[model samples]
Target chain A: MSKTVLSTRGLRKTYGKRDSKFDALRGIAIDIHQGESVAIIGKSGSGKSTLMHLLALLDKPSRGEITLHNHPTANLKARQLNTIRNKEFGFVFQSFFMNSNDTVLNNVILPLKIAGVGYRERRRRAISALKTVGLDDKRNNKANDLSGGQKQRVCIARAIVNDPKIIFADEPTGNLDSATGEKIIDLLFRLNQEKGITLIIVTHDHELAAKCSRQINIKDGRIVADSANETLEAENDDKEEFKDNDMDDMLDHQHPTHHINVDEEEE
Target chain B: MRMLDVIYDANANLLRNKLRSFLTILAIFIGSFSIISTSAIQAGVNDFIDSQVDSYGGEGYLAVVSNDSFDALDGLQNGMGNNKTPIEYNPDKIQTGMSPLTNEQIEKIKKIDGIDGDSLAKEQTLDITYVTSEETDKKYLIAAEALPPGNVKVSLVTGKQLNLQADEYQILLEEKYVNALGYDNDNIIDKKVQLAVKDDYTHKIKTFAAKVVGVIAPSVVSMGYQYTNNKLADDIYQENIKYYPEDMKNKTYAVAVNYDYENYSADEIKDKLEEIGLSAMTVEDIIGTIKSFFDIILTVFRIFGYIALLAAAIGIINTLFMAVQERTREIGLDKALGMSSKRVFLSFSLEAIMLGFWGSVFGIILSVIIGNIANAVFHAPGGFLESFPTFHLVVYTMSDIISVTILIIIIAFLAGTLPARRAARKNPIDALRYE
Candidate 1:
């Protein structure tokens, strides 16, 4: 078994004071192993989004602890939390929050820029990330000029540009039609399988969750069910078929040689 | 995040709102402009004061006179000394007055080590009339006055300065007299002039022949008065007042003292002269009061500039506050992307600082152009601005320019602190949820 990359124990979150007190997340526990694509499924306000935010270190949990690769992260200062976010985690939002004024290339390069990466390397990696999303041809176009699917593609490029070890996607395809949603979901899975990067997604779509290796159902911030899908079961039996030719063109950022396969994929 | 990235992002964001940025910069521009112009005016006033003092042959010496008789020196002059006006002094009245400086007083003044020299301020009555070369008929009476030579700045037309200790009878013609006395051309310096005074001891009119040694140019503070050393003064004083009534005999001299200004400050010398039961006057005594008055004006004028600067600072705060409110989501996005709150704070503050810096630069450039134009308008030969107290109406000092720039930047940085901190401390979840 691959080693566990992240886990939470008795995680709880609350808002407001005294009489106005309200709980956003109830005590719950879970372990997520590396290279596993997991889906957190829940209804709106079921605390899935809150859990995602806490796991991403975007917000502090009121109680309990979070450990990434066995390193406790519950009490890390804001600066250190930000460092972890920059170097280890990538997030794709539901709304595709791309800076409209920036070029698609610039939008992708932002995370690396924030990481204090050199300009030349950041630009090269940003271009490579854009190619991963199959939007390298539109790199110079303004972000807003792209269609919704294309904009989401730019957002995905931005997320993976820094080579984060874990990609936390919150409803990454909520705004897309089924066909576009599948294409985006397929792209995310390709990254997970090819790079051995961890993937945890929060979504309401059952079809999307059925494709993940594991599905954890949540209600009132508590896990109601946990199970592996048939695809994972079939893979364990060595009977799964991997016929996706695009995966051959998947970006190997550590070695730019794989980046050369992109042009042939367009044909 | 690196500092360069923060600034680059800030610049890119500000560029997205071109009009708002321009308007904010304009507010600071007005603030800096007012300060620079006000400082320039004060600098011009300072130059005016120096030239005014210099016109009186500088502020190095003091005048010591008996009683309040020297009051005429202050009340008699107004405006700059662009023209020479005759002095209304009667030597005999002062010489024969009850409180004239006796020999014993002169000896005591000499005893003061700081006192370089002392002379009797005397005026002489002599009939020296000449017809103008143009008219060749109508004679102009030339009134002659004498003083001890130490402080007066005399510009000669042809000949040289008079020897204050010389026994030779000599006269220095005022520039206006060169033409009024009928001597055309500038060749009157060595010309001979005739004058006759009544002899008090002999009670007979004694006529003496004197040579013109020098001619004084028109002065800015004093004019139209002929100058002669104490040697000639003694001759006229004894011949004119030696036979006056016994009580009037003591008034033949009004004692004046010239000292080293470097060794003694004006107030120190004034106090010393007053201690000897005498009144003293210097150029500074007159101009020092004027300087204080102008200083008050300068302070009051700068208050308006500071108010404008305060308003500009508020403008910066208002601009940044609105920016924080508008960019709530962007700020959240930045934090989510791994930008630390401190970096956020620094980025926003730097944007404001850059705004102020650009505003000050624009203000300085525009105001310098405007100031130079104003100066040109005032300092031109026929310009009416020159008619005002300052010949060159505006002046800029390095300190004034630098201080105004730095002060505005500081004010802007301080103004940005509130909004920057707010941006830094924003909750990422709420900010992201913001529309």
Candidate 2:
């Protein structure tokens, strides 16, 4: 019922040429509403990352169009796209990409600095962002000295420093243990619920996907199931191709117990 | 990104890899130091030359000689240095020393346009036997010549210039003669000195007492020659030529003539003289060879500086390329955060410029300090330049300093473009994915 914040139609992306030609995304049409926490679930190389990149405007689709607030983004210049990304979207990565030698406060100030915000004003906002993540006391500490979870929390602080309208998290908790991952997930969902900001997460963790208000399951390059619709049972007739065999194999290699639980719940 | 932020980041990045940046800057500094030092030395030489010219009564005056006499001097030089083959002797051409200018040629020179007829004075070869002062019995061999007519303000150690038209004999003593004649620069002024001339035939030495008008500072232009008033020079020359035959008595080797320098250039006047079987050398023509000699040596040094700068430019390129490689991930993060490609290029270019700026600034500062110390060392007592008090060993002009700095900065910027372009062209995705 909520107004759509971002929508895509017939979005496709291709890599390489001629002999090495490959398609990462094919015919993906989705509408993400304001304040909705949507999960894009798939295995590695399933075009889930490509879809998030296209939606985040970090990349352009090879074919089709993406609309942000009903305004088509295909015709926007590079400078305009950069501004939109700086002002309207935040990003959290699994690896915690940060200037490790820099102070935590400076790391958090990156986005605002790139936005050309005034020095004093940027410092104030960065400190506030750090406080929100409860790392203000460690603001002067070198980012490299922080533990993995603290480092990820600082990366989150950097992402939200500009107060973007949407947060695109790519495996945001992939590097953290379950307890720390839970804390990060709670923080992301709390921001989504309280600020009415859209949350678009790309992950294959079903437990994380189950918590989202909507889930779009992608296999290979096509959307196979949408939990928002009553297509689970109807789409199950295509179950010969939609079996959990591949997903369970990958999960089993990484998390043996999780693989057993996944099989038990599905059966 | 803002300009301030770009510059700030550039300087901070330079600090991140201190040793690499310092080594690159050191290379630039070597180039800058050599270039600026050479420039300073050239400036100092030129300054000293200008002072010498000013002291020589400045412009208008020319040392005029017969064409045959000029040719003879040239032949003597070439004969001593390069012309080894025996020559067929031609009686018409004067082949050694100088040929006397005929009276007919003198009359023609006076009639030439732009030649001030009244300023012509025969260059008399006064053969003085010796010189002595009333205060000391010791006689010193000396060379004294008639001071050229003009507003001649010689760089004097003490006292005033000689009165050209004074009936009483007056002599301006050289600095060496001042102390040798038992009188210092201060008390020697207005004191009497005696010049003795030996007759050509009888070999009789006649002493002429003259008052000391001033003590002249040693200078390259003067060449250690003393100057005397017209009266003293004429009396001395008359005594020396007393025994000569009629034909030889009137023969003149050269003449000092002043031309209307304001209305006509020196070359124009020289051309007029050349038409009348005469050759003339202006004060500039005499001093120009010295300047060209310095210019040649300094130009070689400047070229070496530029070659070093060329090497330093390569060093800058190497340094920045390494920096770009190391900062690939950081650059990706910045690009992803919305810093434009142009700004990224600008930051790297600014780092090169900053390196050049600091290198040149330090070069200038150190050069100035060392230059001053050298100047002091050269002018101290017993130093080579002690006799020439007005000369400085090095001089720094504002324009030279500014131009050198600008030149190095431009080189640094051009050097930077390669790496900056590389940094700019990096894709955020690929750069981020780089391990």
Writing each residue's lDDT as its tens digit, candidate 1 over A1-267 gives 788888776566777865796777665466789999999999998889998998888886665567889887865777889888988988898988778888999989888888899989999999999999999999999998998889988988898998889999999889999999999999999999998878999999999999999998777766677784222222112111132123423421233222222222110
Query: Which prediction has the highest lDDT against the true structure?
Result: 2
Q: Alpha carbon lDDT of residue B58, candidate 2?
A: 64
Worst 10 residues of 1 chain B by lDDT: B126-135
| Local error of candidate 1 at residue A216 (angstroms) | 2.1
Model 2: lDDT of residue B370: 96
True contacts kept of each: 0.70, 0.53
Return the TM-score for each candidate structure.
Answer: 0.75, 0.88
> Can you write out model 1's per-residue Cα lDDT over B158-193, one digit (the tens) per residue?
678777778877777766667776674466766765
Q: Per-residue alpha-carbon lDDT of model 2 for B320-409, expressed as tens digits?
A: 999999989888778877878888899999999998988888888889999999999989998889988899979999999999999999
* lDDT against the true structure, each candidate: 0.74, 0.85
Q: Which residue pairs come into collision in candidate 2? A: none
Please tell me which predicted candidate would have the highest DockQ against the true structure.
1
